[model samples]
Target: MGSGLPRSIRFDERVSERLTSYVARHPGWSGSSAANRFVDEALRMEDHPGVIFRDGPADRRAVLVGGPDVREVIRSVKSARASEPDLDAGMVVSLVSTNAGVPARLIDTAIRYWAAYPDEIDVWIDEVESFEEQSLLAWERRQDLLAR
Candidate 1:
């Protein structure tokens, strides 16, 4: 008997082993579940993507806020960063205003919210097979009493 599903893809042994390891690491998961989760995440990432720059000039905020002097915000952010390496929305807004020539205040507000509320993404499908086993055992006991 077959599920009658067409098999267009194949998984290599190495990939299968890695997926099994991932399932073992995660609580309440199986190897097949891990494989499905990985594919789903990969497809989602491909659908929406951003560019990764290498040593490019910063200023991502100008697009968000309209400003006459974008460079000023960039300068402010750069100056602030000199004292602090760890950056927040304020620094990014300043840089964007400088590069994109947007309003500093508008970008600043947007950045604050974006920084404060980040998205958490997790994927898994779980089933309680143990409960099914218990139910089957109870049903067999009831049938045994009825047979008498």
Candidate 2:
């Protein structure tokens, strides 16, 4: 569509209805443009460890394949390594899956993404750690206030 080449395509009634609905829900999007965008985005996501991007609350985007958020899986792996420095990928998968209720395959998908995008995952991990530290400090302060 972006190549300035025009191509004609046909869709069934159900598919056409869905396209119309999607355009209606997404302001400033036309049916053809939405279809093209979704097709291109899906193709791009297919190459990246089976991960799919989805919109969540407050219009925030999340990377997900099947189970928990990719960040959540990475956080679990980091937490596990804190206790067992020799933990391997398979062990991390087992531990994260057991604790997070996500399947091993999805955990592997998250790990694959992490391998491909270590910098991005590291940023997420840092944010999580910072939040945890803040929460712990707040809890300690509350405890001190109650004991005073």
Candidate 3:
């Protein structure tokens, strides 16, 4: 989690009760922790309209509403930017949007989210790359075993 300033706020009785209930349902989460995560995700979603958080095997991550995960979008944009050195940022986004068949807004939204939480997205990217490398190596081992 990024270093965010802690602010104290008083919730109504009803909201407090709901937070308690949510904590009860989700083990290993305290009321304060749940509330903080909820508020953070709410703020991010409000700031980025097209971004949504989804749960995966690894963890919850920001993803486009009607497209792939934000990590994928950001990675695609990075690749595009690297390959098309002559293209401007806007043009690269447009090209990625066109090729991905998603609206330019979603692409922009992913970039915006990344700007807001670079550390979170970078961790996600690293985890995925590690997983991909592990899978490939396992597959190669299997192929070698079959050859033997």
Best by lDDT: 3
Ranking by TM-score: 3, 2, 1
lDDT of 2 by residue, 32-145 (tens): 788787776577477665687677652323376667667778888888878777888688779888988988888888877787778867886787689889999999999999
TM-score of each candidate?
0.31, 0.61, 0.86
Count of clashes in candidate 2: 0
- Candidate 2 residue spans exceeding 4 A from truth: 1-44, 56-62
Best by TM-score: 3
The per-model lDDT (C-alpha) reads: 0.46, 0.77, 0.89
Candidate RMSDs in Å, in order, are 21.2, 5.1, 2.4
Cα lDDT tens digits for candidate 3, 6-121? 77889999999999998899888887788888888889899999888888887888989999999999988988988999999889999999988878999999999999889989
Candidate closer to the true structure by TM-score (higher is better), 1 or 3: 3
Ten-residue stretch with the least lDDT total in model 2: 57-66
In terms of lDDT, the poorest run of 10 residues in model 1 is 119-128
